[model samples]
Each structure stands twice: as structure tokens, then as C-alpha cells.
Target: RLAGSAAGWGFQFQSPGFVVAVCWLLFLMGLNLLGVFEVSAGRLGQVQTGSGRGGDMMTGLLAVIVATPCTAPFMGVAIAGALGGSPVMGVLVFLSMGLGLAFPYILVAGVPGVASRMPKPGAWMGILKQVLAFPLFATCVWLLWVAAIQRGVTFVALTAGGVVLLGFAGWIYGVGQRRSMLEGGRGTVAFCRVVAALCVVICGAALAQGLRAAPAPVVAGAVEAGVEPFSEARLAELRAQGKPVFIDMTASWCITCMVNERVALDVPSVQEAFRSRGIVFLKGDWTNRNAAIAEFLKAHGRDGVPFYMYYAPHQDGVVLPQILTPGIVISTIGK
Candidate 1:
């Protein structure tokens, strides 16, 4: 929050490289869960450390970083408050949030006999572990979709190729592990692992180059009919004309934004209401890091996407809830 505030709160969003890196991590994690490879006490899936304390600390840090994006929309209010207030207040809010996040784990750890109550090891456990890989795979697909929206098809192709290479590396590494277990051909096992590591490095380097390439042009008027691309000047013009306007500040990577649009904004009833009521729907795409959109979010005391504002004719804009229902939209416009 402090870093974001220092940069005018626009840098709160992740970069294209960060998204691609996370997608790769999720892909590799899925492969690990699917029995493609084992890290053998390495810091990937089912991570192991010689010292339990270091492992626990690293795992906690990793959890916080990964979970932040998923929880940002819901935590916007508190985050905004933290950013807008004093440094002490900001620290308190974050400290409170961390405590809240750790509470469930603390509860589980503190309780006696919790592990004893868990079902004994069985075939079902293996099946469940494999089944869990699908969600990781799905999340990787979603991130790639977000990448497509941000950079274009070429970016996705590059990322997809990287994913394939990662899979190949995993397979090769797994083969080496199996051979080494039989206690023969140690030299061949070492050679296989070296080759697998090289493949991973090559994939990472290629992806880095792809991300550094220029993004595709943002085509105007490509959105759904009746929705206009948002611009500050356009907003001012509409407001000057005493027209009602709804500003949707969203990003492709924002899960809550997608959910709200699907459940409320994209519905027939809401579309009809928008047409009949003559509301100007202006959408700001923050899929890529945009300074203008960042400024707009900052003006509204927000540091993240999924921000919604409604401007009634001749009135100040009214901020809406993070979660929206069709009824909420219809009623907000009807008034």
C-alpha cells in the first residue's frame, strides 16, 4: 500500500510479466500435483525444508503474496482506508488483515486431535489430489485469457509454448528420478536432470522476451454495443450535458469484476433498463497498467479495479458496492 501510495496508487496493479510468471507457476504446480515430477525437498509443491521454521516462514510469505490478488476487490475498502490515512493507520489495517488471514490456521493448529480426526491415507486421497490439479489448470487458462486481453494472441502463444516446455521438462526430470531410484545409470540420470533444467531456463528466457515485446494496439469501439470506452474528457462532456452515466472501472484479471458483470451488467433486464433510462455506460479497461485509469481510481479513493460509480444527471457521482446484483443496478438507475 505504501509503495502504491508513493506512486500515486496507480502501480497497485500487477505487471504483464508478473501475470505470466504466476501462470507458469500454477502450470508447474498442477503438473507436480498430477505426479509429473517431484522436487525432492525443493520449494515447489509439497515443499520440504531441512528446518521447519524456515519452511513455515517461506510458506506463509508465499501464501500472502498469492492470496492478495484474489482478495483485493473484497478488501478494497480497508486497503483504500489504509492508503488514504496515516502510516500508523495503514500499518494497523494491514496487521489486522494479516491476523485475520492467519486466524483459521492458528485455530487448526491450536486445536488438539485435529490431525487424528483426519481420514487415514487411502486411494481416495490420491484421486482427490489429482482432481485438485484441474482448478490449477483452469486458473492458468484464465490468466492466459487475461494475458490475451492485455497483450494479444501472440503473447498467449508464447506463454502457451512456455507451458508446454515446462511440461516436457517435468517429464524428463520425472524420468530421471525413476531411473535413479533403481540405483543404476547415475550418469544418465544426472544428464537428464541437466537437460530438464536447461529446458526450463530456455522457456523462462523466451517468455521474458515475449513479455518485453510491445503490446497490441487497443482497438476502439470493440466492446459490447452501447458501451463506450471511458475517458475523463468524455465523462466531463456527458456530465456537462446533464446526462446520467455509469463508470465501470474493471480489468480482465479481476475475478470480482467479471462476476459482477456477468451477474448484473450483462443481463437483459439491466441492458433494457440502461437503454430505456438512457444511461451512458462508460467502461475503463485496466487489463494493462494504465496511468489515466489509475488516476481515476485514485480520485475515487481506490487503489484497485472493480470500482463502480454512478453519476445521476446534475448530481455528484455515487459510489456503488463492490458486489452488484441485477436488482441493485435496476434500482440504482430507476432512481
Candidate 2:
């Protein structure tokens, strides 16, 4: 179910953060397996005598993350069918993929002896816990790299250093009997956690806003084009212009759509064609959830973004291919 949500929400394995997150999680699991760290499961710690089923679940989740990019043989067809089908069908396709990935673990967990054969809890778990810290450290590095790509190197470096320092401070507090650190007890820890969470929220919001505010890239030899969110009245007006209307139904989360916009759509030749031919460029932003856009998608038999449609003057809309090329856009507009 989570896998489906992730995929639907444009969180693909190809995404840098997704890759880093999976690797970091796996590293943490391996550490647990080696008995370096012990995660408490409330009062049930005694009954749960194994490397840690929670860690295993984490492993399973990582497995899904890694597998998402490889689009299985029939997966592409399934996704296409689902997108063009009903909303229920779209959801079912995502659910099916999740179940397929989770099947192995589900089968193993269901077996009687499989769970019992797991290693019993032991003292060596502490060693495993320490070793697992390295993976967490590695994950921090990966996240920094992703942040650098999306935002900038300086922001990522500072954030990474801050996290490392915080982790070190926490470790020191755990090890030492310093009066200032120990006296506050749960209150201090809880307060610190809240502060950290708030910092994260602020940083994320700032980053998103910064990215949004950044200037759109310029494509030379092409007239400056603007795309507004879709509206029925606007479509009718464009149709009245007696020119081809290239309707781009996209969301902020759609990587393929972004790629096309950055490459094909922004290319000089593509832009020139649109300009000379008087092609009306229409963009439907579906970044946030919108019932109007949802209805628009349903009416057109599509369930997701990167849904390209070419409307010939006074004719029905023609759905364009998902994977776009400059020639495709030009040719469609010329027709």
C-alpha cells in the first residue's frame, strides 16, 4: 500500500533521495542483524527474540524502493491501462505491485518454523548496533548529496554537518553522566526532539519555496511562452483561435514531464515551431490535489499527470505519447 502511494506520488526509485533512503535503511538493518544496536519494542522486548522483525520489515521496504525503477515486463502496460481506466483501476494496479513485492516476506512470516529459526537476542547485539551507525552515517552523506543536487552544495554540507554534530552530542549524552544532560530526563529529550522536528519542517518549507521561486530556464529562438492552469472557458477561447493547442497536463511531482519540459519543450526548434505555427501552449498544473483536474483526468480517461493532449482546431483532443521527443511535439503541432 505504501509502495503504491510512493509511486503514485512520483517517489520513484530513480529519485536520488529514494535511493539514499533505501541504502541507509538497509545499512541500519544490517547493523541490527550484526547485533550492534538494539531497538526497544516497548514492553514486548522479551517475547521478540530475534535479529528484529522490525528491521526485517525495513529491509522489505527498501527492497520495494530498489525494485520500483525496473518496471517489470508487464508493469508498463498495467500502468498505462490503469491511467486510462477508472480511478479504482489505477489504485488496484499500484496495490498489485505492492503485494507482489511484499509476497516473499508475507509467505516467510506465515510459516511456523521460519520465524522460530531466527537468531535469539544476545550481548553481541551491542557490537552490531555500533556497526549499523556507519550506515546511518552513509545515509546522511547520501541525503546531503541529494540536497546538493536539488538545492545547493552549501545547504547540504551545513545540514549534514549539523546532523552529524547532533548525533555526536546525543551519543555523548548517552555515554557520559554529565549533570546538565542527565538532569533534564525525558523532558529535555522530548524538547530537543521537538526542536529538531520543527527545524526540519522549516528547512523543508524554505527549500520548496526557494525551488519554486527560482527562474524558469530560457529556451533561445523561441518566443517566451507561458502556461496557465487549465480552464474550460480558456480552452474554448483557444479553439476559437483556429490554431493547434498543445495541452500539457502535468504535476510538480512528475519527473518525466519535467524532463520533457527541460529538454524537448525548451529546445529552440520545438519553440520556434510553436511560435511560427501559432500553437497555443496550455499547461494544466496538478501539483496539489484538485477535484476539477481530477474530473478533467477522468473525462479524458487518464488517472495521472504527463498526460499530453493535442487539440486540432475544431477537433477532438488527441492523447500524446508519455515519452516525448522534440519531433513528436513539432509534428503534432504541424498537423
**What do the candidate models score in CA lDDT, each in turn?**
0.80, 0.58
Error at 176, model 2, angstroms: 8.6
What would the TM-score be for candidate 1 when compared with the true structure? 0.90
lDDT of 2 by residue, 161-225 (tens): 44544344344433332333557466555655565456545544544454455433322112234
Count of clashes in candidate 1: 0
Which regions of candidate 1 are displaced past 4 Å? Answer: 1-14, 40-50, 86-88, 113-117, 218-221
Q: Worst lDDT window (10 residues) for model 1?
A: 4-13
* TM match of model 2 to true structure: 0.51
User: Which model scores highest in lDDT?
Assistant: 1
lDDT of 1 by residue, 1-335 (tens): 44543432223334767778888888887888899877522344234445556556665665676566567667888988887789999889989998898887777677867756767899999899889999999988988887777778888899899898888888998888888888778997999899899998998899888867888764422578899999999999999999999999887777888899999999999999988988999999877666788889988889877889999999999988888999988888777
TM-scores for all predictions: 0.90, 0.51
Q: Cα deviation of 84 in candidate 1 (Å)?
A: 3.3
